[model samples]
Target: MEFKPDLAASNPSIDFTNELAQLLLFTGEVGVAIQQFSAYRGNLNNNFSFPSDIEEISQQPALDLMFLSDVISKVSGINRLIRGCIEINNYKELINYLNKTIELYKAYSRPNEQLKEALKGDPYKTFSNTYLKGFVDLDFAISILEAIISKCEQNNVGAKTA
Candidate 1:
């Protein structure tokens, strides 16, 4: 990961806490609602136009269990990463982890209308301003990390030649 001076300088404690809280609350509420909706839709016995994959999976109890298990695993992993970042006071790592969480949320959250609505408005900007204090660009941070790694590799090669 890159050593972002701004990431080191900004206060991560409050921002991380708020972000974590929001993620937990949002996922818990929205995930259950989505699952319940899926179950209800299955009970209706009418051929609703859900995605083919979802329709197939909804028919089998085993598949539904597996789907819920996968959701739990992803959410748990995200929570652990957020907490670990907070413990270490690593703002950059926290941002990276949050971005990953957002990606995962985007994947599973599409089916739920309420979740979609909640996340529709410039949620990323809200999160950035509240947690990162408007000082960091996550994409830039990732590029810096890559550059640092490349520089280190070049230095190692030069040392080998000398």
Candidate 2:
């Protein structure tokens, strides 16, 4: 979807600076939480009970037990918070915060080498490494915010030149 610059007005009801700051802070907490989930492999039954689709049979990936990971839920909350902050008119500052958040995700999103290999084995043998990746979802949200910033910049520039 195209970014609507007009919709990027700052909402008097919301304190975007604080909101963005909180999102930035939560990224690290989420990263640590995900790291802790590595121990969950021992608790979850890695074996898939049944084949659901081609991705299951062909890709042979696990059921993405990450859904059970609290990190996913927390990340979703962060995404929602970020979405709310998108209405801020400070495109430059918003973009800066977003880029910083993206960097944090990039630093933490890589599944450990051991977990990566585990996810590749028999789909039925593992409970994770399949579908849900919260980082990707977070990245999509940041990308949308970046697009909106770009559009806002364009609109303002065009208006000044005209």
Candidate 3:
């Protein structure tokens, strides 16, 4: 997958740079956790004896927590970065970051919804709380991001000509 550009390279603020680094690092952790979880699940599917309770699969809960925490950190960091961009009147960078984030959110939204639906199939009603919270937070984050983007676009007249 293509990654975001080096945003900090052009940014002069030390705090923004530091926060961006932390966000990127946490994002990588989330990606790795998801990759490992997918691999583990794929392996389980190939095995002769599959665990009846999918949640009982080794490392699933831990990975879920990691994913949830990473999501929270990354989302908050993105919000902070947005504010930083606005503080510096860097509309170009702000729009770039917002578009990238929105693109990612759109790409992942369907799969996330599917997973949520799957969790609802559990008759025991014992779902992964971490997973649910992550979903809720992600939805909220996207809503906020979209609203910001709408406002930006609405006020962005003639920015392209500048």
Against the unseen true structure, what C-alpha lDDT does each candidate score? 0.41, 0.41, 0.48
Candidate 3 regions off by >4 Å?
1-59, 112-137, 157-162
Q: lDDT, candidate 2, residue 31?
A: 53
TM values, all candidates: 0.36, 0.31, 0.43
Alpha-carbon RMSD, each predicted model: 14.9, 12.2, 9.6
Where model 1 places Cα greater than 4 Å from the true spot, the runs are 1-12, 30-57, 108-162
Q: How many residue pairs clash in each candidate?
A: 0, 0, 0
Q: What is the lDDT of residue 45 in candidate 3?
A: 54
| Clashing residue pairs, backbone N/CA/C < 3 A, model 1 | none
Evaluated against the true structure, the overall lDDT of model 3 is: 0.48
lDDT of 3 by residue, 1-162 (tens): 345665545754323444345445545545544543444546465555333444643334454544445354656656665656655655555656666766655544444555446544321121234434332334445665655555556666214312
User: For candidate 1, what is the TM-score?
Assistant: 0.36
**Candidate 3 backbone overlaps, count:** 0
Question: How well does candidate 1 score on lDDT at residue 45?
Answer: 47
Residue 33 accuracy (lDDT) in model 1: 32
Clashes of 1: 0
